[model samples]
Target: MSTLTDRLIYIVGPLKLQNALMASFLERETGAKCLAVEKFHDIQNMDNENTGQPKLALWDCLGNDMESCLSEFEPDFKEVLNHSAVAFFNVSPDLGIEAEFIARGVQGFFYEHDRIERFPQGICAIFNGELWFSRKIMNEAMKKDKKQTGLQTRYETDLSHREIEILAMIAGGASNKMIAEKLYISPHTVKTHLYNIFKKINVTNRLQAALWAAKNLS
Candidate 1:
């Protein structure tokens, strides 16, 4: 397994002091260079000394209003995911939102209630190509898989070839306009297909439909 020294780690948060403090701690713990980034976009600005080094971002999701924080964070998600293996820190311990983040391609999570000592090991684990979800979440996911095995097959079978193609594009973070252009179809036609895809898969939005495609299509 590769050590964290082979990559760069960014501690991203709204608060500069917090980001810096976390970055310092990680540097000491992992013997790897860590950077403090107040904004996710800031990661793009900094030039990487080693272009081949893997990048990991520990995003601080701690706030009284998590909904607002998350909503604000979503827009930059695709961009950041393209450049880094992103993980959430200072998250609520409930594990209720783990599935949503997983669908959005987050690499791992560290709850606020988690012991500080555990952070290094968890971060190391993530760098070792392991996901850092709670055991409870893993068990729940396993249960869901078993229960939905037949339903997933049905959903897969019900999708048209074009719809399947569109779903795959959606999972790849393509917008409706992009998909339409690539497929040589109108945006309105794309919307119609999306509506049908959502209905057939029992999802209400593009995110859910994308997640469904990720699990069921491939």
Candidate 2:
């Protein structure tokens, strides 16, 4: 597995001092370079000059009003999604509004009051191309999956169970290789599954599939 030293991590939020302290902690814990940005525009400016390397972003939505912050950050979040970078939300511990952010293409969700020790592990999971949602949030997401029993009616009628699984993983921000590893299948098989999933869902790429999964599956 790769360490955080392999890539850059960007932390964005309205709380400048909090973000800076969090960045410092993360840097010390993981030995990964961390940047604390006050706004999405700062990220955009930095990204323009960034070398093409793997990067992860965390949007801290703890201090501000959730609805207001989400509304203000939606467009910037969409831009992050377009870049295919891993983006997660640092939110209040309550799972009340998680689905709203997930619908906006957030890959992971972290509780603001979680122990700082877990931060490194969560970051490593995301860095390694896996999800980092809290157990409660993950269970809620899975429960939502179960509640939407009529998959055929919700999405394309032709999508099989395995295809739906792949789609959900994609929406959870897993790469093809990661998906294959999790399912104990080869990368080629994962690609084949994705191809069929795209065809069934009438989507052209992973990003489209992800968005579709978020809207329909969740």
Best by TM-score: 2
Which runs in model 1 stand beyond 4 Å of their true positions? 1-3, 47-50, 64-66, 139-150, 154-218
Q: Tell me the tens digit of each residue's lDDT in model 2 across 10-129.
A: 888777887889889888888888988877667777877766766778877766566686676776776765553545456666537665554455666667667778788878766654
The stretch of ten residues in a row with the least summed lDDT in candidate 1 is 138-147
Clashing pairs in 2: none
- Among all candidates shown, the one with the greatest lDDT: 1
RMSD of 1: 11.9
What's the count of clashing pairs in each model shown?
0, 0
lDDT of 1 by residue, 76-159 (tens): 777777667788898887546665566566767898888877888878866654467754564454345446554545353578
Report the poorest 10 consecutive residues by lDDT, candidate 2.
Answer: 144-153
Alpha-carbon deviation at 20 in model 2, angstroms = 2.4
